[model samples]
Target: MKTLTVPDETPVFPLRWVVATNDEAAPLVIRLMLALVLFPHGAQKLFGWFGGYGFDGTMQYFTETVNLPYLLALSIILIEFLSPFLLVAGLFTRVVGVLISLLFTGIILTAHVAIGFFMNWNGSQPGEGYEYHLLIVAMAVSLLISGGGKLSLDSKLAK
Candidate 1:
């Protein structure tokens, strides 16, 4: 018989805990952000909203200038318009991400990169060029790798 004392042993990981909690919110938040940003851009291309070059205008650029077939142009438009909706809803996110990433890459090469990094579309001093597209490329890449996360429609659908 003897008095025994047990020493407390606990590990403290504040940063890990923070990241874990933040991860819980990452899926829905990221999907929403991507959807909100992309949907309007897609809408502009597909439906000609906010001064977007409608189907005809886009077709001229695609078929004549870009040398793409009408079918290809239509595919691009459909992919852009539909994928963003699926992305926003967090459905089939990886597939949408892959398609969107390819679309953005084509846009960067065909339009934005030629104007140079710092030049705007109107050839103004402060350019609105490929930088934004590059950023979107990065986001698409992330979504492709990570999937929709725990809080997504993907997860719900899986269940």
Candidate 2:
């Protein structure tokens, strides 16, 4: 009788099929920067930090002034609060990117477009413009295409 040897195989996960790793600094920096930028907005909306309207105030403003449905108003708050953390953690990067993009799109179309490209430059106006939102969208789209970078939890979990 002849003895046969089996080769070792690495275990695979379903996430491995869906997600890829780059382990590059660009995506990692972008992800971190985006989180740094957006987290403050979330904190403001959720906790009234940085002079932002708290949840109740935002809900009222979105409903009465902006005329958005309550659900949408609430969703904006929750997404703002939650998405940045997930992005920072590098978990569910693609989904979070899409969601942030959508949220910013709605903001641009409904509010910022009318305000123009610059945000009350030289104190000439009362509100901000679409430029910031556009920048956010661009960053998010990049992450959507690339997935999270090397330091992300997504990469670690995939392995």
* Model 1 spans with C-alpha error above 4 angstroms: 1-23, 119-128
- The clash numbers for all candidates, in the given order, read 3, 0
Clashing pairs in 2: none
- Candidate 1: pairs in clash: 119-127, 120-127, 120-128
Q: Model 2, residue 93: displacement in angstroms? A: 0.9
Model 1 sits at a Cα RMSD from the real structure of 11.5
**Candidate 2 TM-score, true structure as reference:** 0.86
Q: What is the C-alpha lDDT of each candidate?
A: 0.72, 0.85
RMSD from true fold, candidate 2: 5.9
Best by lDDT: 2
Q: Name the top TM-score candidate.
A: 2
- lDDT for model 1, on a 0 to 1 scale? 0.72
TM agreement with the true structure for every prediction: 0.74, 0.86
Model 2 residue 45 distance off true place after TM-score fit, in angstroms:
0.7
Worst 10 residues of 2 by lDDT: 1-10
